[model samples]
Target chain A: MFDINKRPEVIQLSHGGGGKEMNKLIKSLFFSAFNNPILNNDEDAARLHLNGDIAFTTDSFTVSPLFFAGGDIGKLAIAGTVNDLAMMGAKPEYLSCSFIIEEGFEVGKLKKVVDSMVNEMDKSGAKIVCGDTKVVPKGCADGLLINTSGIGRIQFDGVSVTNIKLGDVIIVSRDIGRHGAAILMERESLALETTLTSDCATLWPTVKHLIEAKLEIHAMRDATRGGVSAVLNEWAMGSNVGITVKESAIPVCDEVKGMCELYGFEPFDLANEGTFLIALPEDEAIKALDIMHEFGCEATAAIIGRVSEDRPGKVILKTPWGSRRYLDLPQGELLPRIC
Target chain B: MFDINKRPEVIQLSHGGGGKEMNKLIKSLFFSAFNNPILNNDEDAARLHLNGDIAFTTDSFTVSPLFFAGGDIGKLAIAGTVNDLAMMGAKPEYLSCSFIIEEGFEVGKLKKVVDSMVNEMDKSGAKIVCGDTKVVPKGCADGLLINTSGIGRIQFDGVSVTNIKLGDVIIVSRDIGRHGAAILMERESLALETTLTSDCATLWPTVKHLIEAKLEIHAMRDATRGGVSAVLNEWAMGSNVGITVKESAIPVCDEVKGMCELYGFEPFDLANEGTFLIALPEDEAIKALDIMHEFGCEATAAIIGRVSEDRPGKVILKTPWGSRRYLDLPQGELLPRIC
Candidate 1:
């Protein structure tokens, strides 16, 4: 392990000056954790000989309370980008990470963040090939903001929001609103002795299984920020089809349910990081669920909704009490920086 | 133009919440500025068909005094990442932009920044394909920070920092330290009444000419952050070769020279965003200079250095008045956020 012995306990502006200090930090921490031939080449940019169709995405993670129940900013940074590629039927490959760290942030804390990122990358088999770091003066930034951009090679095609068919069934990978609930719990210090960890995880493994199962997935998106409400509404508008979902079929844990009720917020409007919804033909929905179940994220794999031709460009939700209402896109901020 | 009249002048948290307001802001501002087919797909990730050797680079711009004399953070963010690919002899192609803006920032100012980005991308003919936006509460971030990750195709090879050959002539593309000096002037509100603009620019046009000219280009790098001094030191150490340069041959305009004198700084150690250095065979140096002059960025291109076999892993500088010394990498903080 490399020690921050000679250096001050806090980062200085020189460390981001593209000089000897910055070089040392990169080699010792970044290169050490993400050790690979392509990254160690020391060129101005990473040289990748990619072929065929590729998927590219970028995300900036600014989750407050950097450390949370089940993950940290670093873990979310890696998973958020990997999931974006997976949803496009792409095999996650290379990622570029850039950090804007506030001056006076503890070196020990930075090490922990890097370690968390390395551990998360292992789960998805993605390598951080290139990175940049900049340090700002005290009070300039809250703590740190991480940006991750990823590249992946497409393994299959025909997955898009506009590809939804009228008879397609929507299958959710796992329980919803756990990530948002967990963040709220941490922010309020709600230590109710509940193991309510955030559902912040890498979704490529589960997504790969569905792909291998040969299910003709029409659309897939993680219910992030605006939660399932946003995804369902966007799909309806883009595909010009109506969506009907059952409130009872949507999975929500007791802890999350309690939090939602206490805060007077709808579960569908809360954000999720790990949970994803897939739209496929009704005949293939069972096979997708079976593959998702075997992957063992949880028993929450379920078919909760289906596409309809009745009302185009709208999502209707049927409650257990036999009442129906429009599932509108969340209008304003539900939870900021929940990713 | 999409008006901010229907919206609040100050950005709110709702604009980054992945909801209706966020969607409206994206389509109205970002989508309009970076309009392209791939970006209009409205998918989780952009699909691209690429082949052969590709260069990938990432950079986060947090330049203080967002607007400087010659450029703003938006322009710097685009040029900085594009130059990284050009240094590897790649043709700039696709870029992913992610923005982290603080709440309460003026929407008008944000539009100006996005407009600047569009102008900079025009120079390199690169398209913005995918993006993510997040907003932090007021005081959580200092205005806004942008992270741009780019992918380009390498047209030529052997442009590694470790590929410098013995007896190669080192050419400075233009006068150095203008970028760092310009930023300092902006930060301090220096009313020097001088036209000292930053050297920040896209280098693909100049690099394309070099590749077309078919010079035996061994190495090329933009002198950013630690400026030319840092680049030379790294090359000497990485290639295990000695480099000797004449102090008087390095071009420094009167404005930059005056700033260096007033601040007790070394021009070689200051940053240069657009200026670059080339290492090629001595016989091909003049041809490279002629091509650079015709490009018309400036006529300050000159051969200020040479690679030698003596004193491996070191850079030696000879002064005009008959003094010599080792030009080591800049140690302490020279300037922060000068890119």
Candidate 2:
């Protein structure tokens, strides 16, 4: 007997209040989408059965525009935290999501975002077992912000930045900077004919495939925020080893490259939500790429660099002209609220 | 070689850009305050050892006027989620906090908040194992919002809203409405000579003591938004039993009473961050109150109501003059962002 016409079209402060309205909103909207035994229990907290070593990670998605070409904030929120656990060789399992939404936000938009989250969760078989929702007065916040914290049982062990050794091959999962480019395009309201989209996707499927294949992954990290440059620089300093990358070998889509040229930015320093880097023995690179290609969202995985013993604690970029230079970590603000 | 004077006085967008500056801020501020081995690992996720049945909860704190009497948002963020687990008779163990800070906020204020979080965590022996920080442009958000998600091992079983039965005595932890009144005072810049402060504090100690005392607690919940009125209504509906409250037996401070009188608010409908309500067999009320009095933040615990089978799914309020009325769940917005 639930009527769509009876529901409020836009969110209100009362929806965040811990009373009848809040309960009705939760039961009708949130419960129907994220319905599960644990969440259905009208308790203050969700009870879970967890054993052995678990991986825990958290991320807050404040991506502007709320929605982009390939994804929205909800999809990015789920994928971002799930990728963190997957990078640690963990089986993405239980997740906790909290939303700080602005009052007067369209209810239809909220439902769309939640539906996107449910769709993304299916990729990794993760469940949103616990969540919190708070509605801020309009003008106090932009629109909506999501914080997703995940807990997963570690399925594979010994994956660490310090584990990267000399002769390790570095692999990039796909072409870089699509997520950043997509956001930039949406923000600038570009009307290009290209079918460019944000590369926001769940990486657990590919990670699970690699784990099942028993590839020895030394280090794995998604190139987010500061992008590939930041990840490489951290890896170099963390392992006290030098990394040499061929600039020409690094994958970059034409749309991202074009956007970078237009904005005077570097593709390697641009963020990517779905792209990840892996370091393993040189001999295992082919097998890992094959497994990733079969299960990854995109089939553009490539070997972009390698770990070296020379010039420790630095990342060397070798240009197509055979000139070598140090690649430093990204400095200053590139794009704020780019997720 | 970390120089305090060398750091930026205010948080810049660069500090959350996931680059060198972001690394420095995290290592210098967050790491120094929440130092732990698991966090120092610097992996994408923190590896943890967990066993048995655990409780998981999430909460987002967006209380206006970040600093209030008796507590701040940082303290409330930790205590709020910890209380949820504690309410379920769980031992608060691991927490993951995410921050969405506005650009140009003072770094000094941020540090003070982080320090407050550390102090609050000490009360419950909970550690923040993983976290994420995001910075939005100025005007995109109001100062700061924190999301804290917690995991705790359940030490006591079968404490739930559905567990309340007939003859169960309901107990109020302490004087209510302080948190709401304090926030209202701060927001309104009230200069009353009353020493009214929020009742925000970690409830894990009291919950732990009760668990150790082996009290067969049926249902426990912190009276947050909508206060004791919300908890009683939900319990009545959830357990299919009627709740009868002696309005005169409830404890309310003079300051809160005055504020409610001025604002035309009901004390039962105001929020309390630290105050809690418990339902158990009448025979165990004395022992439970004794244990709570010894370890709880306040000693004003009182038996305010009882469970009955007369009017299922409803709450009855008995006035001092032998008048009775139905106390329904709060409607409309009592107060937004009270947490």
Candidate 3:
């Protein structure tokens, strides 16, 4: 219930000078949002009690248009790193957040971003245990950039890209390309009459359910920047197996489909934040889909493809026209700062 | 041993697009520089074996000049986070690095920065277990910003800012203000013909020696952005004790002194990267000093101050002219983008 509006209107250089202003900002803003014992210690580092196999990951969110359709950089920062741990079959536990804010940025927007981060952390039960803030002079940086590093305890073993096998089937957690399309619309200032939103959400709930169901998942990856095409290509190469993806089975919402067609882009190449691809045995595909559905995954979760022995180290796309083509790794920059 | 000279000339948007070009840049540049078993897995997150109490910390390096007199941003990124863990009496083990690069940045310069990071990590025996890279459009960001979040096992316990007691003496590891002075000179293009280098180093070796020597250190901290004055003031307020400092006892290099005089700056208010402050029993000061000296700490290490019961929650400076003054936390921005 901290009234962030009452603080300074804009961040000052002194706020990051590591002096009284910096300390005041840290305590009043960051400490208020991420209230916890470990963070409140005010020590140079957070003392954490961690055990067993742990997963560590880091991401820097420079997504432009900080405020997008469904989320902002703060929410993406938390969900992005948490999803990485969740994909590794780890329970998201602790995270370290660092922000590089441009001076003159509004403090209210920062508070909103922090609020969104807090909301997202609630989904995975992750805690922001340690954080650092730096404010650069105006023009030295964009409005804001967030870097989050997470540590999680591995609960399930043997989940990796190299573990994908020929008999495994690929499952899409939800509709694809919403994140990219949404950002595209926001950035382009498209006035299309559509209720399209970015699929920026935490995947830990669905991932947890899959884990709790005892499904033998071989590999899991969120379609972030390069979308499904990049994930499929990496899996095929890493496992030394062929991945036959049914292009028609891939779920792309109507708005995203229209956006891709208009922009001469492929849906498979568009990014997604919440949607993910799961590789598992064919027998577990149905159960995985069921669990995903039970968790309100928007009824878009479906079996999108299957792994095979032929064409090792390649991903083959079976088009709706009954033709096939190589789904190569994305070649050029589809979108800069797309998350 | 990697031939970094063979890489692309400049980083393009495709290098951070999460596609083929991005993959190539990562494999050729990052993978080669930070080769480790855990990082080579190519998983969404790095799998690590961690146990017991661990220290976690994060820092973002936005130093104005990418390269400085004695080090660069990469070195500061590693040493800064590693020093935080070391200050908490932890054995630096794993680190996560994330980079935000501006498009059109020279790849050769990036390679040199990476090399500096590798060299700095060697001092702490820390591995880059996981990392992320993002490229922002030109004009969105400066050349580069590196965020390093570190994890370490707590080797020594009970090192807290609140542990400072009235009977403890304060010791500084080496001469201060060189880092701030070096950056100031670089930014202002000063033509001072002096060998004033930044004290940018990894402090794990010195801290490790102190712990091994069985010194009952109560509190330890690196004088970073806010400098020695900030550390002392924070210590006093955190522990609810008074601190009396002999201003003449502080170690300041002649070059730094000259710069301070010319710039009308206080040496104690300037920053230091490698220098640190330690509080221990007054009787054990000599033993701690001996260990520091034997471990190659420069002869500048000295007892600069002590804790006191009078003037609680304040810092008193004993000037050379038989006068006393209160040294409050630095009020304004001394220097921005200073580590």
Candidate 2 lDDT over B88-169, as tens digits, reads 8999999998889999999999998999999999999999999989989999999999999999999998799999989999
**RMSD values, in order shown:** 2.7, 2.9, 3.0
The 10 consecutive residues of candidate 2 chain B with the worst lDDT sum are B291-300
Question: Quick one: best DockQ, which candidate?
Answer: 3
- Give candidate 2's TM-score: 0.97
B1-339: candidate 3 lDDT, tens digit per residue: 889777669999999888999999999999989999999998999999988999999998999899989889999999999999999999999999899999999999999999999999998899998989999999999999999999999999979999998889999999999999999999999999999999999999999999998889999999998899899999999999999999999989899999999998899999999999999999999999999999958999999998989899999999999799999888786889998
Q: For model 3, what is the error of residue B195's alpha carbon versus the real structure, in angstroms, after optimal superposition?
A: 0.5
lDDT of 1 by residue, B125-240 (tens): 99999998898888989899899999999999889989999999899999999999999989888999799999989988999999999999999999998889999999999899
Q: Candidate 2: misplaced stretches above 4 Å?
A: A1-8, B1-8
DockQ scores of the candidates? 0.84, 0.86, 0.87
- Backbone clashes in candidate 1 total 0
What is the C-alpha lDDT profile of model 1 across A1-339, one tens digit per residue? Answer: 887676658788888988888888789878998899988998889999999999999999999889999999999999999999999989899999998888888888889999999999998899999989898888888888899999999988979999999899998888899989999999888878899989998999988888888888999999898999999999999999999999999999999999999888898998888989999999998888888888846898899998999699999999999999999999876777776
Misplaced by over 4 Å in model 3 are A1-8, B1-8
Predicted candidate 2 versus true structure: per-residue lDDT over A1-339, tens digit per residue:
877678569999999988889889888988899888988996999999988999999998899999999999999999999999999999999999888889999999999999999999999999999888898999888999989999999999978988899999999999999999999999999998889999999999999999999888899999999999999998999999999999999989898989999999999999999999999999999999999889864677999999999899999999999999999999999899998
Backbone clashes in model 1, listed as residue pairs: none
Residue-level lDDT of model 3, residues A225-245, one tens digit each, is 888999999999999999999
**For each candidate, what is chain B's TM-score?**
0.97, 0.97, 0.97
